[model samples]
Target: MLNKKQTNTIEVSSDIAQVIQDGQQLVAYMAKDGQVSLDPDLAQVMIDAKYKLQKKQWNAQDEAHFLHSYDQLAKAVAPVSMESIRAISRSDNDKPSQAEKAVAWYRRYTLVALICLLFVQVYYLFGHALAHDLKDLYESRNEWHLKLDSEEPNSKEFKQIQSKYEEVGQRLDANYNLLKVWNRIWLMGFSFGSEIPPYSQEKLNVELRRLERAQADANALDNLNLAQTRLTARLQLFENMLFAQSVLEVLQGYVLPLLYGLLGAFIFVLRDLLREIRAITFTTDSEIRYRLRLTLGALGGMIIGWFLNPQELSGLASLSPMAMAFLMGYNVDVLFAIMDQIIDKLRGAMAANDGSKGKSIQGSGNG
Candidate 1:
């Protein structure tokens, strides 16, 4: 009976034989002398077959066959001029170097960011347009007259109405202003929700009656009702516009940034997965190390994006554009760094506060 090693060798031999049989046509085509020219079709087939074989576990015999077949095909096609070789759009063997991969990833994310920025630009445009529309709506003689009659411009009641109106308009405009890049960038939103009129006739009438009482304008009651009704309609439109803008902000701000962050994290982690899991702090494998660095850098970029994104009170009201997306995709690391600093500051403040409290207690005990 054969020993274990001997049995394994026999099995390997059988596998090699089977491979050889399977690749009979490939071998025959390559080995044929003066019969098969390096025709483009044959070249393609040889390359394909060679790639498939390389993917499998090959014994010495299989390796030998591969080398021989490859050499034969190479020699067969040697006479074919380089100019005659058609450029293949893509190939499995065409593995890009680290630098090439980096450039490719950078470009890909940059392009994605640009697209997001474009969407943001449109969003801002919508905002600016909406602002203008609202102004126009409020500017009509009937609308203006009703507002004027309800309360004097300088009066507290009139001021309250003006304040509320300006607050909404300014919120929209402030978002646009904050979003501007070098005082030039702007954006807009796509209305994504159904328009629902906020004020019913009964609601408007009640509100108008209250306004009439505030002004005691029994003579202008009819005009005030009409003007208030119009105002309600405009406010409803404003709400719809804001809803649409918020949806886009969530997509561009939260969803896109999160996806980008996850992508970068996964890519970086996958590159050094084995080594990272293996606990090899000092890596000897240059390829693995390089991949790890590349992925980590990408993830870092994503973190920075999150940090830079407006987290201020007015951030939600701001436009989410392609520029922000690009920043988020490429500078995610910066964002993380900022968050780390904030956390550290908070920790320090808490420690100081605790120390102060301890001192106070000590002083009290001494007294």
Candidate 2:
């Protein structure tokens, strides 16, 4: 047992086996825990050991041994990483103070309330602008008072008034100056021009002449039928102008704001998802999931902006886009939680209703 050659041979084999075991442990730990440390000689020895292992036909026991080591490494590191991500400290694990809980709740609820207020404001501003536009249109049209309220339509006085109205209408149509008006509208955002005559002379002439002959009696002249014709003309003019102004208002109040919010939402979602993937899975590529989250966030923001009426809330409508952006960025999880609760309630209600219906049907059958 003490022969020099045999003793040296045994020592060399023991050293080789130690090197192999160390290399295996190092690689398994590094793979699972994302840590590495090596000197040049040690690194070389690990590489050589790994190469030798690869050449050998490993048994099930060999595979199990490596897997077990990996599992141990993962378990050791996972809690630390998770705790770091979640911001859970030793104090948090213990009983939280009432003051600490209150502060946390205050922060969350205050943010939610502000977001809701911002939504209200956006809708209010949009609605206020629209209402103002409509009001102006109504006042401007009413000032025309184009109806010839005089009793005798065939009289010289009535004819003279009618002729003057026609002249003004014709001049307005001919001198519309489309380029000038369009430039003004583009620059100023809105306008009401008399270029498009609210009432057509041909229709006015026919209605006036018809009413004059058919409703010639003193009482008939006072009847609302004559006034209805003038109202119709006014309505047509208002309809045309409202259509144009509505398009402008919608673009400014809804479309542009929604686009800005969407852009903000997309960026926020992408960044958050990328950070999550990096921290948790490190090697996972989540481009599709990121894009999907971005799209949903953007669309959700748009829907919130759409429902918030600016006119009703007036000054508050100014905050709509900002609120929507905030909602997309931070409040999305809270919103989803709230939505889940609502859905659950609705499902319960529906089930209850179905049960009631079934009971009623049974009672009816017995009766």
Top candidate, metric lDDT: 2
| lDDT by residue (tens digit), candidate 1, 250-325 | 6554554444544444444344443432232222243455455445544554444444545452753374533344
How do the predictions measure up, each by TM-score? 0.36, 0.44
Worst window of 10 by summed lDDT in candidate 1: 81-90
User: What TM-score does candidate 2 get on C-alpha atoms?
Assistant: 0.44
User: Mind giving the per-residue lDDT tens digits that candidate 2 earns over 244-326?
Assistant: 46655665555544554455555554455445434443211333444455556555555555444445557646665656555
Instruction: Show how many residue pairs clash in every candidate, following the order shown.
Output: 30, 17
Every model's Cα RMSD, please? Answer: 14.8, 14.5
- Evaluate residue 267 in candidate 1 and report its C-alpha lDDT on the 0 to 100 scale: 44
